[model samples]
Target: MIVQTLPGRRAFIRENTRLQAPPHTPELSLHLADEVTPIWRLTEEALEEIGLPPPFWAFAWAGGQALARYVLDHPDIVAGRRVVDFATGSGIVAIAAMKAGARRVLATDIDVFCEAAVGLNAEANAVAVDFTDQNLLNAPPPQADVLLAGDICYERPMAEAVMAWLRRGREAGARVLIGDPGRTYFPKDGLEKLAEYQVPTTRELEDLAVKRTSVWTLP
Candidate 1:
């Protein structure tokens, strides 16, 4: 079933976020939350205020920003490939894949409001990205040549689940690429480091203003 966006959700996102270029990847513009705290503090009465899940889509996270920069600079990674940006908060990487000349891009986030957020941001960047809220864990690998994920190792269970799923995608012959800010749970054993970037982020969101982010591919 097509999940229709709730009333005022899209407008609320537009009103709450600011259109700006992320610090690390200025080649593309995105609709992003100017600050994290305000959205973080939103309450249930904030329904018409916004029914978003934690507003992860509001901020241009360091990992996503770094991955986007990599894709923009290295278009060959995704060019002419069908790609999927998993847990695509703010759709930054997905937008970059499309901008980098991917044949098609599907940005999937479990958060319901992220579809609206991704669409709005894609429009701002003049790129096309398909957004979905399906939880793809335990499902068979998607029909994609490339799979991209950023900052997915924050929580232990999620890290385990998504990493297992990503491994399946790799087993199916898709190139699995991930961007991370050195989170503790990031799997250390089987990845090839591709690039690194000093991503500027808010202290309110991350512990530091400049995070050392890296892009890696599965072995």
Candidate 2:
């Protein structure tokens, strides 16, 4: 159960997830875990024993779904631009940006499993997305035309750090966007609302079957 190689991770993902479209972004497909998947039943302790982090990359969270939907619907935002999808779980937003005609996209996450997940999902959607395991927060602001983050404000320290980094990206002239479903730590000010959606999710993941999520950009 300990996945140490890319092939092992890919096999685990293939065995534990199904190729399905998120309810709010049906145009794209991803390898995702549902209630019926074995990964969904793993407890935190179980995951820790297996040397796996929480399988966040295996679920299309409501905020990510909303952001992906908005990107697909507003192609002009990323058309011909370079994009970086922060915390690119399942590579949903990155794929959406590529489908919307972005010249290139780099998907970054700290989880090692996410590299495989993003690769598989991008291949499924017939788009090529670059993946990185480096923690972008440790470096200078990303050099790209657009920066996208989704569902990242669950914890206060992490949310504050990420928001500060995103603000730096905005100051450096990159368009910064975020998608959140009313997370406790998400800042309530200084963002322009772009779109909102009632994204369908599982209770096991969100405690609610549908989440009212919104996409916002730094003004």
Candidate 3:
């Protein structure tokens, strides 16, 4: 299905599909399609075996890399806590939060396709995540103990809004952490960097072999 909606002045166009988990890995290969290029495939079993779920929006460059690295490093952040995986694309961060022992996980995305993608990927990983497809601007603020966001700062206005929300979360006593790959808009002053990694990115975006990404906490 294709959806078109106007959130104020910005145009939002999304194509989405609802799918079930595959009985075997072969039936569940994640695809990455570049501009004017054929889809590249990576299987679910490959990701699961490596302790990851399908990289939902891998084509976005920084998001996927930050998510993968976050899971590998700070699974404890979500352990025994209520979590909100903001802008959850492939449900990777949500799944990782669940695996890390989050009591409950809410995966959010404004994109309609994310509704199904997150559900399928969560089921495939045997993780339970409540999916919210509502626009963040209109939705209630999440009441989770921990808030996780990855690669949401590429765009200026979105980044600014997200930063404001995160600041509010911090003020409300929720632990707010973000995984960002040095995007131009990431707030630099109040955040304490936790971990850094070299991430996979595309040629169209940047020229680094691995982009430098970090997990930062708002102080």
**Among all candidates shown, the one with the greatest TM-score:** 2
Q: Report the lDDT tens digits of candidate 3 across residue range 1-219.
A: 012222211111112222332111222322223431211122222222343333344344465446545654666777889988888876667777787678998888875446655665666667778988777655446788988888888779989998888888888889887888888888778789877767665564566756787878887
Tens-digit lDDT string for candidate 1 (103-141): 999999887678888988898989889877888885976
TM-score of 1: 0.93
Against the unseen true structure, what C-alpha lDDT does each candidate score?
0.86, 0.89, 0.63
Worst 10 residues of 1 by lDDT: 1-10
Off by over 4 Å in 1: 1-7, 48-53
Rank all candidate structures by their TM-score, best first, as comma-separated numbers. 2, 1, 3
How should the candidates be ordered by lDDT, best one leading? 2, 1, 3
lDDT (10s digit) by residue, model 2, range 127-146: 99998999999987779999
**Model 2: colliding residue pairs:** none
- Which has the higher lDDT value, candidate number 2 or candidate number 3? 2
Error of 1 at 204 (Å): 1.3
TM-score (C-alpha) between model 2 and the true structure: 0.93
Kindly give the number of clashing pairs for every candidate: 0, 0, 0
112: Cα error in model 1, Å: 1.5
Off by over 4 Å in 3: 1-61, 204-207
Q: What's the TM-score of each model vs. the native? A: 0.93, 0.93, 0.72
